[model samples]
Target: MKPAIALPLLGLAPLLGASDLLVKALGIALVALPLLSLFGLLLPVLRRALSGHALWFGALLLAGVLVGLAQLLMQAFAFELHRALGPFLALLALPCLLLVAIEPAGPGAGLRQGLLFAACALLLGALRELLGHASLLAHGEWLGLGALHWQAAADGLPLFASAPGGLILLGLLLALVRLKP
Candidate 1:
């Protein structure tokens, strides 16, 4: 039998564990599951809107605005990593624009465009996290964040948080985005 089925038969809590891994898995399931579902529902509509190259361009511009707003909010909160958000947002833009750029002006293009932005965004986020962690290891601190010791063991590595499992969620989002139409 599958683990999900066997776990209950064994009288074990499916969520058993005190490790950060359990917490992170729970966090991703809680947050990303809904987001993925919503994206799936919204994909068709977004593809329709992105039918035209002009519309695609406009959407990219809007994504830029949204990313900017996200950064602005991060800054307003006095977040230590405010500067990093801009680069991450920019990284998101790549896949968003790629869908439009690669799109051929014809039928079914709408179906192809929906999750491109989200995939690009996730990939960029993962890359950012990895690069950030590497930088932290090299310098013993996150670059541009001064000497704020972002303890890797307890908190997380620089590229992404550990418990929350942001990278896994990111990977899932990318897979969802790349789904065959």
Candidate 2:
């Protein structure tokens, strides 16, 4: 399954405890809806005879890096929604990177895959923000991360809280390193 389709479901874990029954149902729908939409968007492309799995993998890894960076920004800005949803979404990047690193094939395909993944990430991020805001308004707090709205916890560590992104970046770098002749 596409990261777009999978990340939001994974992201729901953080939000589960904080949400009420109705809010939880809404949240689940909100997350699942976007994945469904992304699936619709991607299905046509997937139906095509595209065989460059490696490039697609690299694209996904790149998209993960971008998603991580966005989450880092959210953390920096103390966006509670991001703190809740960011890491889980970030996790999707790994399998894609591994896929690319192990069996990447073409050159341009990675770029295409990256663009597709980026589109999905952007869509999911926006949805999360909107749904989170709504959930907070209705329930008096965001879904998962609670009312503790503070800047990212600081111990001056690299990739401190956003470790998933950091790991994905490391994976991407390693892939590149291995790809080098």
Candidate 3:
């Protein structure tokens, strides 16, 4: 797959998983930034040390390790969220590996890509929550906050809360981005 499509396609699952709740999205962004930042910094150096299949294996291993560490940290401090995220947290590694493969050049490029992904996660998460539940951060309690939420409507488009809704919203957003001036 092309580099651009590869990362998002691989990442779509985790993005959908996290976008179910705004708090979950925050959890993902918090984890993704550091994971990608560290991964970005370390992978370039590791690439210099390996080649061929070894490089791919090493990159996968590295991404897995980084994701595992984030999972452990989440489990410890955010047990509820960790459980809610479930396998989706592990699926995060796929995008990381793809990110590493596509931008093996330098940390900055990888980090920029990571930031873009994290931003998307946050944007999608917030939009989904607002549209689906008519509230933002409505379940901060899930993240242990329990006190911060904003409700603006009695009901919202429930479809936005589901997987299909996420895909539809994503397509619309992609279409918007592709629009010419």
C-alpha lDDT values of all predictions:
0.37, 0.39, 0.81
Number of the predicted model whose lDDT against the real structure is largest: 3
For model 1, how does the per-residue alpha-carbon lDDT over 55-155 read when each residue is reduced to its tens digit?
A: 66665675565445545654665344343232433333333344344334443333333333323333444344343343232222222334633324433
Candidate 2 lDDT over residue span 1-181, tens digit each: 3335444234323222222223333333334333333433443343353446754654564545555654565466545554445345444344334333333334444344434444434333333323333222233254554453333232223231233433343345436756957
TM accuracy, model 1: 0.34
Which pairs clash inside model 1?
A: 24-163, 129-159
Compared with the true structure, what per-residue lDDT tens digits does model 3 show for residues 1-181? 3476645677656887668778988888888888888888888788799988998899889989999999999988898988877888887787677765574556676577678778888889999998998888877987766788888848989899988888888778778988999
User: Worst 10-residue stretch by lDDT in candidate 2?
Assistant: 152-161
Deviation from native of the Cα of residue 63 in model 2, angstroms: 6.9
- Overlapping backbone residue pairs in candidate 2 total 1
TM-score for each predicted model, relative to the true structure: 0.34, 0.29, 0.91
Q: Which ten residues in a row have the lowest lDDT in candidate 1?
A: 11-20
Model 3 pairs in collision: none
Model 1 deviation from native, Cα RMSD in Å: 14.6
